[model samples]
Target: MPDPSQKRPVIALTGATGYIGRNVMESLIDDYDIIALSRNGDAKDNEEHVEWRSCDFFSFQDALKGLRGADYAVYLIHSMLPSAKLTQGTFEDMDVILAQHFARAAAENGIKQIVYLSGIIPPHEHRDELSRHLQSRLEVETILGSHGVPVTTLRAGLIVGPDGSSFPILAKLVRRLPAMILPSWTRTKTHTIALPDVIHAFQQVVGREDVYSRAIDIGGPDVMSYQELLQRTADIMGKKRRFIPFPFPTVKLSRLWVTLVTQEPKEMSYPLIESLAHPMVAEARQTVPGISDGKITYEEAAAAALDEEQKKQEEKKREQEEEGSKTPSPVRKLKQAVKSDVRSVQRITLPEGQDAIWAGDEYLHWLSRLASPLLHIKTTRTGVQQVYVLWWKKPLLELTFDVGMSQSDHAIYRITGGRLLHAKRAHNGRLTFLQIPNSRECIVAIHDYMPSLPWVMYKYTQAKIHLWVMKAFGKYLRRWKHRSTTDTKAAPRQAMSQHDSTVR
Candidate 1:
């Protein structure tokens, strides 16, 4: 219990921009003076009690400035990006460097304790690639402990909430996928905690002194599989979803499929899928009283997510209707005309002796080539040396091709250029195309109706696809040079043929 008479602690928190860190910040705002550290330090300034500071944990000396006069600091930062360009070192090594720096900073500033959120890796469990993520987290915990700051480490899994990636993606997938062909790992058991429970756990860590310098695994009352969680989510959403489990499951492939449908980043989904392969249920049967006094069931968590999603949808619909009413009919029509075209082809002519046209064209091709990989697309030049653009609406699903399976049922393709445009989706095992005039460029957008999917994947895919399409247009211009050369050579032959025909 928090004592009213006690002096409110000045707490410095890292990862204030992240999902979990956001929630932790919100919960602790009224209770403590917070110096929130972020890479950009661009969080909203509405919270009167919170002071934002920019700090790169990679540089400890600068980050330590924020920790000065802090009573407790929360380390919620994790480099989950598989492609994060950290200094050439092991994940643990990088974590150790950051942790040591943070610890030294906190110690110099007279910080009393460090609170960390980490995933539980049960004793005797084999350390694998997935375990490395958890190991790095634990390494940071140890580093903080070595600084003589009392460390409270809470190990949790699958935190269910409105803004969290785990539940949102799961809920979206369950709602969007009417019939799910699941991997064998779908049956593996894991524990999950609700967002409120997670917040409460953090609150307990901050208020209690006895629990300092210790680690505890926190979970809900029930342990279940991904399949079970999906079914429960469907039930909460009032939808019936069929889930069929395959005997042999490849989690990597599964992760790719989810990435396509949900638009979650590959780095974020990879650890999740890999961890699901192993049972993450708690080893001890008894619950820790200090952590969770009452367990929130999976069903309840699903219901909360569903409720939040519905509320958001209603709010969005209202906003759209209000905007629609405010626009004049002519303006709306003009906007539609500019935005709708589907298929566009432009031809360019270059001077016989100059290469500027070809150079400009090649620049476009390079741009598209660079962007295509980010969308997980393979680019190939045709025999004509012309660029041919072909991509699925959801490119992440292409990973299923590795397993000889295709998401033909879920595939969508949209092509729009100039004044012609078409959007097609697979329905009844056939492509159903929707024609819209004035749509331009191929913007491969995932239309997941469910709110559970991660937004990062969608934004990243959209950005990559737009960049690649622009590149394709650039390549098309360069191809014109070859056509011009051929046309010049054929000009004399055509004239001679016309003269010979006339004489005959």
Candidate 2:
């Protein structure tokens, strides 16, 4: 619990887009302002109190800005399966360099504490016997603590989540492989935790003075072998595996085989295969209220993750159906002077109603991307008007569109003014969002009159444009559904605050 006397502390979270980081953000959002650091780039839309900061973790100066202005900075970045080839030493060496840079920046920024999530070490810690993955975790922990800020290290074993790397790999193998050619490594005992448990553990350590500057192990209560985990997961997935133990150890060969079977990259599979030999179990766990109490069983965890995943899959299917229904029908088509100039396509409905507001946002994002590869867009809001400046290929062809009276069900926009005189000729442009009679599906239609272009050219060109936009819009809807589903998995926070500032 945070002290009521002090203001809500800001948490600078690295890897905010990662599995653990995202979950942690959702878990602690009510208690702290979040800074989501990601490589691909964070959304620029101003979220309430969550500020997204972009940083190149390798460069101290680059990370300095993002690390600054925070009471606690959660270090969740790791390169187990490095996306890029390492020119210097190994992944461990790169990890150490990154950690040193982060620590330096954090100390300079006057960060109160640093929380790091690391891989769990086996019950019996042998420096010589530690896997490369485990060794890297320990080394990074030491480096972060070496700096001025107090470091809270929470080491976890296999994390089971819907989209997590480990559980899916095991589930996929069980689902795909007819029978298991079990290797000796399958018998190695390791602790495993549900994704929720890991999130809980991170939150539990946030401002706890007792846990600060100490290494703590966190895992689900159950400890089991790889074979048991595989079998139990298979059972939950309703797939039975016939395991036959094989005495052979072809560590290198297995990596290639896993890549071939699982279709995962060597960078990801190689490290995972190499790390399987170690028995990863926690030696001791810190007693935290939410984390250490009332643990769920492995079977229960697997079933719960799978159940939630199944719901998401179903919701996505519904969203797809809703998007497919948006096509304009023959009756909805405008009769133009040239028949070819007017094209309308329409199709069918989902049982659950999709949010009209979200559909509008999707349409906007789709429209912003539809026209050209070289096009750029700038959006600003003034009072009730949404101003969009579109540069089509060249600055000379720039168009400024002013959208007014926009609502969940409909919106009206006109070319207002631009460098091109012909744009002013465009008028009465309206996007109507209609809900299917009794279904959750919505039909979004955009019909505008552009008298500036020749009727013949307008007809065919408009049809082509509509077709492309429809295809692109379908993809955008899919992405939206995916993102929304992922957000829900975080279990949300009341009055959640996210910074509108996004980092890429």
Q: Which candidate is the best by lDDT?
A: 2
TM-score of each: 0.60, 0.61
Model 2 is weakest, by summed lDDT over 10 consecutive residues, at: 491-500
> In model 2, where do residues sit more than 4 Å from their true spots?
81-89, 123-125, 285-294, 313-504
lDDT of 2 by residue, 1-504 (tens): 777578888999998877778889999998888877875445454377688877767444567888878889999887544322112125664565567668878988999889998777775668778777777788788778765789998877788887767787787788799797888888888788888888888888898888889877778878898888888888888876898888876667767777788776565677777788888777745435565442767788888878887897798778779887543322233121122112132211312345444454445445656644444344433212232345343332222222222333322233343332245453443333433322355544433323345655644574466567666675555455344433321211100122112211
lDDT, model 1, position 79: 51
Misplaced by over 4 Å in model 1 are: 42-46, 82-94, 128-130, 285-287, 313-504
Instruction: Give me the candidate number with maximum TM-score.
Output: 2
Report the CA-based lDDT of candidate 2 relative to the real structure. Answer: 0.63
Residue 41, model 1: Cα distance from true site in angstroms: 2.4
Candidate 2's TM-score reads 0.61
